[model samples]
Target: MTADLGHGVPEPATTAATGGRPEGHLGAAGPAPQVVLNLARPWGEADPLDLAGAALGAGLDGVTLADSPRLFPDCLLETGRILANTGARLAGPCVLSLGLRHPATVAGALGTLAAHHPGRLLAVVGRGESSVRNEGLAVPSLRTHRESLDRLRELLDDRAPELRLLGAASGPRTIRATAARLGGVLVDVGADPAVLGKAVRLVRAERPEAEIWVFLRAVLTRTAAEADAAGRPVLGSCASRLVRAPDWYDLPAELLPRVEAVAAAHDYRRHGTPAARGGAGRSPETERLVRDRFLLTGDERRIAGQLAAVRGLGVDGVVLAGALTGVVERLNKLATAVRAGLAIDPAVRTGPAADPAAGPAVRHRPDRRGRNLSAESEE
Candidate 1:
């Protein structure tokens, strides 16, 4: 049973609380869709040991090791080992910067794991930000990123290991390209229902068979008030991330300034601010629009409603960003609520979570521009 993306496209409904069919295409009798749990940020100093414990306890399906090189060097291998040891689902760490430099290297690292793990890896990609830049690398444009991803797939040689590499894109062009080249697109930029609908429509127009997932900040609070309070930072954090780099998500150029403003105000170091990185402020109009469009704060039922709204728009799955508490506890709580509400079985694990090509399909065209670019991505 394919889920209707509220637009004309049909998606598969799932029993899992994370909700959705598999990341791959859903045939008439395809198996269940896997719910991907992304662990992009550190849950406030929560140790990896504790994080694993919480995930195992909550019954998550998978985990995505983040893009921070300093934070996730051997950490990826360690996390993979832990998840495998615990009998939990394991997705690739899939740090995006590596792909920016060497798509083959990214594939090799993950491909080696897929070969070993066999059926437990899901590869996710993202637009590297300050972290990527900090490493002396420039963020790849959507076009370049898509092309690189296609190259990585070519390098894979259809191994069909337990892995599926997904591209992170929200812009129309990227979405269309993703539908053209890769397995799916995970919209990690804007959580707005309208934006989601637009993305799905753009992708569906081309690859009607592509998968679309929404990554949202979620809190299953004790009450609506608590949920709202917890939700503020999640909203601000997203705004901060997007406002700084609107192009990453293919946001409308007009709305970019607005997002940047709100992000500036919501400093991670400041009290009541979401724990996000980047510089601060913008014009009043830009701030207001960013506040209204990107910030999503509310209760669980409300969050679920917001999620439903997004679902109605076009998302295949909701990678709920759990509350910002200590890592272990928060992951535990998130896994419980999201899994329960989405009807996910206790047995499933939530692993981490993202493109394309064109006419004549000129493959592996040496990127003259990127060749000179060091690993450090420009902002």
Candidate 2:
């Protein structure tokens, strides 16, 4: 079926002709020099302004505004203002897809955000049963999904801004559509490099210029014991998510049972036998699995190594998965390590900002490339 992803949305003309390495190909240039981090306020407890400030303090690249729009409506707009005030890059709705069915609503929301943040805004779209259920909406079918993307593209063109639309989609069809129509696709989960490679190829094939990015979870430990112990709860789930490769070594062995359980729960039993446990993000076992698979735990080297693996997998950058309480600190440590590895400048603070509520007064901070800083650094 021909889905009507937004019209006038420019499609990448040719992947081969595009001036970059293929997805999963981290060349001498190294992985894309962008990192995204999460800064969420706990349900009913997070202040968007506070979260934004912390991200700036830690010199984070991006601050993804989480749930509780009631607490911070037009969160992107507010975040853009904060980023402008501080010079921190921004990205989000990391879990928001409520307006996917209504292109007008999407346009209006994005229009407001662009008006406030202009080039600072990134329109991320996705679908999740949990998110849709929470919003009292029905989960959309794949066909509808394609249509939604089309509508979003149309809306984006109507908005008339230079900002990019970042799609948080990974399934094959969604990835293909994203490549064909949008500026970039945010691969937030999954661990199969081959799968990601294929997704990249699809995008590159249709639109070589389309940016391919991967979001990864990492946790480092000083020793195997700490890594194992800290990773115990989520080990199985993490292992299950990993599409095994000879070159990668961070997958844990202790969490096999949880992995099996998670695999079974997701109908991904082709990977291995089902464990005695059951389900995806439920139960203590499942919760642990989720933690292990989605978090990077260990020392700096270990963490950096895991990220390196991600780079080898053809990912452009990693959008950090972190908890609210320690996210800023984690981001700081991660940014430092990754920057050192990539040989990028280490000073990435959202500079000279005392507060988020203050009106934006942005300054131009160019990268070593002499180009304006890219929003890709914003998670």
lDDT of each: 0.49, 0.47
Q: Could you estimate the TM-score for every candidate?
A: 0.66, 0.62
Q: How many backbone clashes does candidate 1 have?
A: 35
Residues 1-379 of candidate 1: C-alpha lDDT, one tens digit per residue? 1111122212223333221223332211122233445454443544444454455456655555555654343435655564455444545554455434577777677777777665556666655543454455676776577668667766765554225556666455655665566655666656566565666656545554455566655544464445334544444556665655566456688876666555555533332224442334435455435444554444345544554455333234555443343323455555544544444222232111112122111112111112221122222
Clashes of each: 35, 31
Top TM-score: which candidate number?
A: 1
lDDT of 1 at 334: 53
Tens digits of lDDT, candidate 2, 73-165:
454555555545544444555544643336677667777766765444545666643335435566676567656766777766767434456
Which stretch of 10 consecutive residues in model 2 shows the poorest summed lDDT? 365-374
Candidate 2 residue 232 Cα shift, in angstroms, is 10
Once fitted onto the true fold, the runs of candidate 1 whose alpha carbons sit more than 4 angstroms away are 1-33, 41-44, 72-75, 98-100, 221-237, 240-258, 263-292, 310-316, 322-328, 340-379
